[model samples]
Target: MPQLDISPWPMVILSMIAALFYFIQLKLLNFTFYNTPLSKPMKTQKHKTTWELKWTKIYLPLSMSQ
Candidate 1:
C-alpha cells in the first residue's frame, strides 16, 4: 500500500473558518438585498361557534375510557 499525504492542522482549521465566514457574509448580503417588510398585519377570522369545546367535552371521557 502507498503512504497517504495529509495537509497540516492549521490549514484545515483556517479553511473551515474561512468557509464559515463566507457563508455568514453571503446570508447577510442576501437578507440586506432581498428582505421586505409586511405592509399590514394579517387579519384572522373569528369563530362563530364553539365547536371544539363541544366536541372535547363529549369525546374526552370516551377517549379516556379506552
Candidate 2:
C-alpha cells in the first residue's frame, strides 16, 4: 500500500484562513456603502374587484374523496 503525502495541506489551510480574513475585511468592514436616506413609501388604496366582492362555494370531484 502506498502512503499519501499530506505536505501541502498546511499551506492550503493557511491560504483558506487568509482568504476568509480577506473576505471579512473587504465585505464585512465595508458596510457603510449600503446606508442610504430612508424615504416614506407611497400609501396605496385597495380596490375591490368584481370577483372579490362575491363569494362562492367550491366542491371537489367525487373521485378525489378519501
Candidate 3:
C-alpha cells in the first residue's frame, strides 16, 4: 500500500472538534431554556425553532425602540 496519505487527517480532526463543540453548545442551551419557569412549557420543539418566532423576537425590539 502506498504510504498513508495524511492530508485528510486534519479535516477529519477538525470536523470531530466542531461536532463536539456543537453538541456542547446545544446541551447548554437546552438546560438554560427548558428549565426556565414558564407557566406552560413549550408544546413542540418547532415552537421555538420556527423562523417566524425568531423573526418576531428580533423584529419587535427594533420596532418598539425606534
Candidate 4:
C-alpha cells in the first residue's frame, strides 16, 4: 500500500467530534421541534359544560350524595 503523507489520527478524531456534535444537535432539535404543544385546536369545542359536569361529579358534597 502507498504511504500517506499525513497521519490519519487527527482526521479520525475530528470526524468523531463532528459526529457527536451532529448527534447532539439532532437530538435537541427533535426534542424541541417534534413535540406538539398542549393547546386545544381551533376547530375543537372547549366543552365547558362537559368539564363542569365531570368536576362537579368528582367533588360532589357528601350531603348531596346521601
Candidate 5:
C-alpha cells in the first residue's frame, strides 16, 4: 500500500487565486470606453426603365395547326 502526498496543492491553489485577482485588478484599472457616432438615415430613389414602358407579346407553337 502507498499513500499519495498532496501537501503542495494548497500553495498552488493560493497562487492561482492571487494571479486571478491581479489580472482582474489590471483589467479594471486599464478599462477604456468610447461612444459610437450616430448614423444618418439614407434616402432611396425610384425609377422605371424603357423596357417596362413598352408592351410585349409571346406566341406558343402548340396553338398553331400543322
Candidate 6:
C-alpha cells in the first residue's frame, strides 16, 4: 500500500468554531438571565424503574471513587 498522509486542519477549525459558538451562547444567556430567578421552584422528574438503573449502578463507576 502506498503511504497515506492526513492533515488535521479541518478538524481543528471545526472544533474551534464549535467552541466559539458555545461561548457566545453562554455569554448571551448570562446577559439575559443574570438576576432573574425562576418564578416557580424546579421539580425533579421521577423516572420509572425497570431494571435499567440497577444494572447501571452495578456496572458504572461510582462518583465517590472518581
What is the clash count for each candidate, in the order shown? 0, 0, 0, 0, 0, 0
**How well does model 5 score by local distance difference test?**
0.88
lDDT of 5 by residue, 1-66 (tens): 889999999999999999999999999889876789899897886678877898877666997976
Off by over 4 Å in 6: 1-6, 33-66
Candidate 1, 1-66: lDDT as tens digits? 987667587899999999999999989987856569768977998876877556553355655755
Instruction: Give candidate 6's error at residue 11 in angstroms.
Output: 0.2
**Can you give the lDDT of residue 47 in candidate 6?**
85
Taking all chains together, each candidate's TM-score versus the true structure is 0.37, 0.45, 0.45, 0.39, 0.44, 0.39
lDDT of 6 by residue, 13-42 (tens): 999999999999999988854677669987
Tens digits of per-residue lDDT, candidate 2, 1-66, equal 999999999999999999999999999786876768799898999999987999977889899976
Over 4 Å off, model 3: 33-66
Check candidate 4 and list the clashing pairs: none
Q: In candidate 1, what residue range of length 10 has the lowest lDDT sum?
A: 54-63
On TM-score, who's better, 1 or 3? Answer: 3
Candidate 1 stretches with Cα past 4 Å from truth are: 1-7, 33-66
Clashing pairs in 1: none
Error of 4 at 18 (Å): 0.3
Return the lDDT, model 1, position 11: 95
